[model samples]
Target: MTDIKSYMEEKLLQFEPYMLDRVQLLQAPDSLKEAMAYSLQAGGKRIRPMLLFAALETYGQDAEKGFDAACALEMIHTYSLIHDDLPAMDDDDLRRGKPTNHKVFGEAVAILAGDALLTYAFEMVASSKLYSAEQAVKLISMLAKAAGPSGMVGGQVADMEGEQKALSIEELEYIHHHKTGRLLAFSVMAGAFIGGADEQDTKRLETYARHIGLAFQIRDDILDIEGTEAEIGKPVGSDESNEKSTYPSLLTLEGAKLKLEQELDSAHEALASLNRPAPLLKAFADLIAKRNS
Candidate 1:
């Protein structure tokens, strides 16, 4: 099996240039394009796109075939980050080791850049010549649901509402499942569609994605408490400072760590249910469990 680190790094090299070139061609105002490009190029783990490509690799499909959807997924993720950093939201001033979009581009231009990225994401998928009508439809609809009111947006609202309030474990799960998990889930499901997964196959993979998604969030919460600003690319204890409920706050630090392990274990079990080798997908679960940034 290829080393997951090596595999991920190699894909990152290929994908960054590809996605940036597409952004460079957008015929928009200079300030808008610059804002968009700045956030897109800012350092990130690129976990969503990597998850999509991993799903494709699991099915023995060429990873390149998923690039359009991958880029679309990343764009949506970037847009969310931009909006989340606004004065009205998380009010963060830093992201991925750089100034937040609103801090760099001014609030108006930053908001517009976020809007552009969100809208352009759909165009990236819908205009793809590679997918069949059915595939394109499924991809677009999954992405829409994952990122829309029933998914990420809904979670964001719930998260905002839950701030400074003690939430039950179930309520917390709902917030994370939709906010982070849904889009992460879409990454895997979209790849499954591209690889022609059957209903059963999709179910198993979706299970894996959802578990890893939770695991990913738990780790982020832990990092907020334990990680240095240099490693996490933001100030530590931001969640605590905001009076937001997080895994570590609800479950003790040890409990959150245990929860993270449980989620990763479940993700592996779901992959095992596939009844075939899926080294890359399995490795991704490991990545989510262990990633410090």
Candidate 2:
């Protein structure tokens, strides 16, 4: 009997210190360092990096080769969280059970911290030691597009603009796919690329990434409604309070749950094409679907 949770947690712990060390090595002013470290150290599940490692392992490659890319992804993600918590954005007060970056570091510093992380992430990708120059460029380009205006940033813009307005399912799906799904997809795709997976396998993994990413967001919406603050580590109903559209709001709670299951099924179907055991990937999908927080 394998405890997938503990397994993933151990895997997350493995490279986190590497990332922390990289952040510390930056020659920045104390305030900027503190601000950046604050949110970066404020840990979440480290799902993006873990997915990268898992995907690499799926193709019988050493996960260490993807470490730089994994760390880069996490940095981009952390920067997004910092920006998202700013007063101009979601205006969040708390994150992962603690005061948000802005709440602790002031809005201006928090914004700068996010900007620093975003730029530093590209530096990390460019300076990776394990990959060829060509591979590095590919990784850098993939991350930029995923985190750029065409992807997460664009989705955030749509989300902000969509507030107080009813969005159709197609419109909402676009938001979820681009905003959250792109990076997650990149995690898998990048991992596959590093692992020497064939094009067909990479495409299948992309489909898997899409399904899991949407399921992850849908579950987040469901948890916002059904999960307790203690469990979710933030105030529930904040979405409704912000008047933002959500899966539960759009599909109804029951409908959202059904959609979640359907997405999960679609994810598994995508995995079936791999013809290889993906215990971690399967466990990850189940975890996303069932997470209380």
Task: Give the top-scoring candidate (TM-score).
Answer: 1
Q: Across residues 39-127, which tens digit of lDDT does each residue of candidate 2 receive? A: 98896788898889889888888778888998899999999999998888778899989999989989999999999999999999898
Ten-residue stretch with the least lDDT total in model 2 = 1-10
Using all chains and alpha carbons, the TM-scores for the candidates as numbered come to 0.98, 0.97
Reference-based lDDT, each prediction = 0.91, 0.89
Off by over 4 Å in 2: none
| RMSD in Å for all candidates | 1.2, 1.2
**Clash pairs for candidate 2:** none
- Encode model 1's per-residue lDDT on 48-90: one tens digit a residue: 9999998988788988999999999999999999999999998
